[model samples]
Target: MFDIQEIRSQFSILDREVNGKPLVYLDNAATSQKPNSVLDVCHAYYTELNANVHRGIHTLSQLATEEMELSRRKIQKFINAEHDFEVIFTKGTTEGLNLISYILTQKLQKDDEIIISYLEHHSNIVPWQLLCERTGAKLRVIPIDENGILQLDYFDQFLSEKTKVVSVNQVSNALGIVNPIEEIIAKTRKNTDAYVVIDGAQSAPHFNIDVQKMDCDFFVFSGHKMYAPMGTGILYGKREILEALPPFHGGGEMIATCSFDGTTYAGLPFKYEAGTPNVGGNIALGAAVDFMNRVGHENIQNHENALLEYAQRHLLEIEGLKVYGEKAKRTGVVSFNLEGVGISSDVGMILDKMGIAVRTGHHCTQPIMEFFNIAGTVRASFAVYNTFEEIDLLVEGVKKAQRMLS
Candidate 1:
């Protein structure tokens, strides 16, 4: 039922060549390439429906507003949120995390604790650190093992009645480990009344998310990581929780009425979404969501899981190559290093020369690098369009890098 070639044909960039070879885009963990459907929808939005949302009374404004709100509904359905208004448009996962931190920390008191994990992206970590500095809250970290899995047992020891918030990534961007978020959320609830926030920037691309089932207070993800354009993402919060939190940014759109005496903020999502939004990008993001639903996430998961397995099996064939985070569950990412490779960037450059794209360096998780006791590892992340043959090319490229750099 799953047609790999049909799926590949939808992405126009896959036909292009880089450095005289077909581009094997394995850098999906950074940002995914867009499909023609998303591109076409974006073009149509700009060409036909280019107008500001909410404030416009003209026909174009009404149409644009409809599309923008439609995208919110689409995201709500995609994540199975209880209410469409719970989905707030954000620039991306980073902005969502920062917004959540800023609003939630207002409730914190001195000596209140915020719990995070060692597997978190810097986006998930730094905002909490800044929040702690602002509110005098203590930042607690749940450690991970050498295999890159979280030491979940330690979560009980850190979480207490004083814990105000708990932020974690559902998937590690650097290591591609699928964290036990459901279990984590359940445990956090048992220990304290902390608000649980999940960073789904990586996991959203590979798995189906049901916020109602997961029962997390806040969930955030980037559209670019899941075949949508950059500068578009979503933040889903419980309706009451969002209403309770103060406005993140203040401006024209987020306010209900402004007077010389006082100002009242808009209801639900609009209170948090200040200023003009990216209407075109958000519509395209809706199209991207539709594309995923059309293709079916189950098919995407099966195909990507197969690719991950194939890549891991073949990559291990090379001598002195060490793969990080061989956890029980993972997404379509492989971060590895050759025994003799002095720097990850060198290996990445060599792979690029061969038209194999991968991510190098600390990947914005310096804490993860510190745990690994290395600078970084070369990461090759797959998407739905990627094939096993591309994985072969990547393996060969890694072997070539090992030989040439050694």
Candidate 2:
């Protein structure tokens, strides 16, 4: 059995009341509530080891460097990367995706193709589009099925010699759909020499990620969504591919030596991490990895799956209510809207009044909304501390709203 109360105590902010009522923070997909251990690790970094990393001869500076390098090793084991240098600390998923686009476009010639999917967040889509515009390379999109799953039939037809890269979300952020990435990569690789990039932002937190088994060329995920501090992300690329790729930016740590004639770039992690990186945030991510290990992801996955099933059934039972991505055994997330609500934000606001928080709007997947013929869906995402009683409360709240409006 999952200990809801035990997990609740781990998050300090979860204890606070919202709108004079006990807070039911269903807005976890936006960002998760961090545990005290994660917070304390971040705090300890500033208090004990505050210094710029990699360039200091002082005691504190050496300690800071130790912490950052150790953090990299932790991330290596966290995602089970083949090599430690393959893990690059980024600002977040947005930066990681942008780095891929920047690196690929620098190498690809005109007419080269990088395929993405409609299920991707705007962060994944816009950067590649920008890169395509710069390089005169075309951006191809793999269409999705009616249920928000990626259409593999269309995917096979799209992959060819022209395809140089394939970037996809492992889990749809807006739809709560787990993509068939392993199969997609297998077939896509069979057809041509395209690099496979998996956005594990949603999947990393909920499930155990074994990139070796997946064989994705690149993997990206944000730290904040994984119970770590914001301002940190992980980019795990195959070592040879990463070494062959050009650096995304030029600056302080990323240079071997500066000269008016020419400049040589730094090696590996330093090459990708241009300037002063988030030392404290990177250390906190290590703590998050430790936290997840302590509380087994199997337990986390089972708990959340139960919540998703219960919430999906309850949401559909209500009049004129529809739950999108009604995939059984999905990660504990539901995207839906009430009938005749007209605007999801209105419903979201009302739910907030009752101390039930939810996310509203296109959820950074405007293309997905366009494909579904919906402006947006009200999203209620779950975490470990979330309960069946909370789902019951949400059902009651929605029923109250429906009746009041009727």
Candidate 3:
């Protein structure tokens, strides 16, 4: 049986108090709270197996290597990648997208087009902008509607022979609206031979990911957003596509054999992984995956959906409160602003005094903020452990803020 209290118990931070009140954590979209399993695994790895991976012939090194590779396999199965070699460890989603953009500089020429949507985080936008600046390529964007949903009709118009890449997020980090990635992939495949990249940083935590079913050339997500430690992430690509691209960084492990004359790169995953990796964090990521598997995605989705609906309904009932993306299908995020509240930071500060932790500002999504003709929105994003009672506190806190500020 899916027990909310049992699930909440696994996260020790949920029990803590802030400002003399219990911490009502709703800033999950920025980063999720770590469970006991994940924290324990990280601690165990450092205490028991503290050695550099893929280097020495010692037992500690061997064990460390095994644990890291085992984590890779877990991620491969998690995303349903065709091969384990396709999963490359990255610093996070930003680094993963930047890696793709940097490597594709070789393929992208002058006048070549890269397509991204307005819903993208700065990580998805700035890299492509830099790529275009370097290669003299053109950048095209798919528009969004008033409801903050992607204007799918305009996506077809952007597809053409010159289009070399179509990179988009599976879910909007700021608005929490799920994009039609499968449809986007289908359209890209039918119209052009462009490479499709799905940034799963927001979606990976809430839904089951199947790279094979999505049929995208590349997919990337941050482990920290999905209950793992910081500095751990995954970048999965088609074997053929990954093999064709050159190494992103030149360092010790990524080389086949170093020589004064010339050098050769290593195989699939190692080719991308340079220098020392976060062995403990990767192992902890595996534990995080195991934890999610134990909880089951269906239960997580159902619980979070309830939280989203209930929060939205109650938050909207407040006078002078406006919810962004209210009509769109979203995960567990609610973005809103009060009528008289000129700045989002003011509201966030007031909520902080009430022990409600919510994110404020553009959320690294300036394009989305621009579209709404506002400076920013107060975003309250949920997770598996968040409760309806906490959400009630959030609503009441916002009401208090409104009364105090407005």
What would the TM-scores of all predictions be? Answer: 0.99, 0.97, 0.99
- Greater lDDT among 1 and 2 belongs to 1
Backbone steric clashes in candidate 3, count: 0
- Over 4 Å off, model 3: none
* Tens digits of per-residue lDDT for model 1, 1-406: 7888998999999998889989999999999999999999999988998999998799999999999889889999999999999999999999999999999867998999999999989999999999999999999999988898889878888878999899999999998999999999999888789999999999999999999999999999999999999999999999999999899999979999999999999998899899999989999999999999999999999999999999999999999999999755888899999998879999999888888899999999999999989999999998999999999999999999989988
* Weakest lDDT window of 10 consecutive positions for candidate 3: 151-160
lDDT of 1 at 200: 97
Task: Locate the minimum summed-lDDT window of 10 residues in model 2.
Answer: 324-333
Give a tens-digit lDDT track for model 3, residues 206-234. 99999999999999999999899999999
Candidate 2 off by > 4 Å: 327-329
Estimate every model's Cα lDDT from 0 to 1.
0.93, 0.88, 0.94
**Order of the predicted models by lDDT, top scorer first:** 3, 1, 2
User: Where is model 1 more than 4 Å wrong at Cα?
Assistant: none
Best by lDDT: 3
Q: After superposition, how far is residue 116 of candidate 3 from its true place, in Å?
A: 0.3
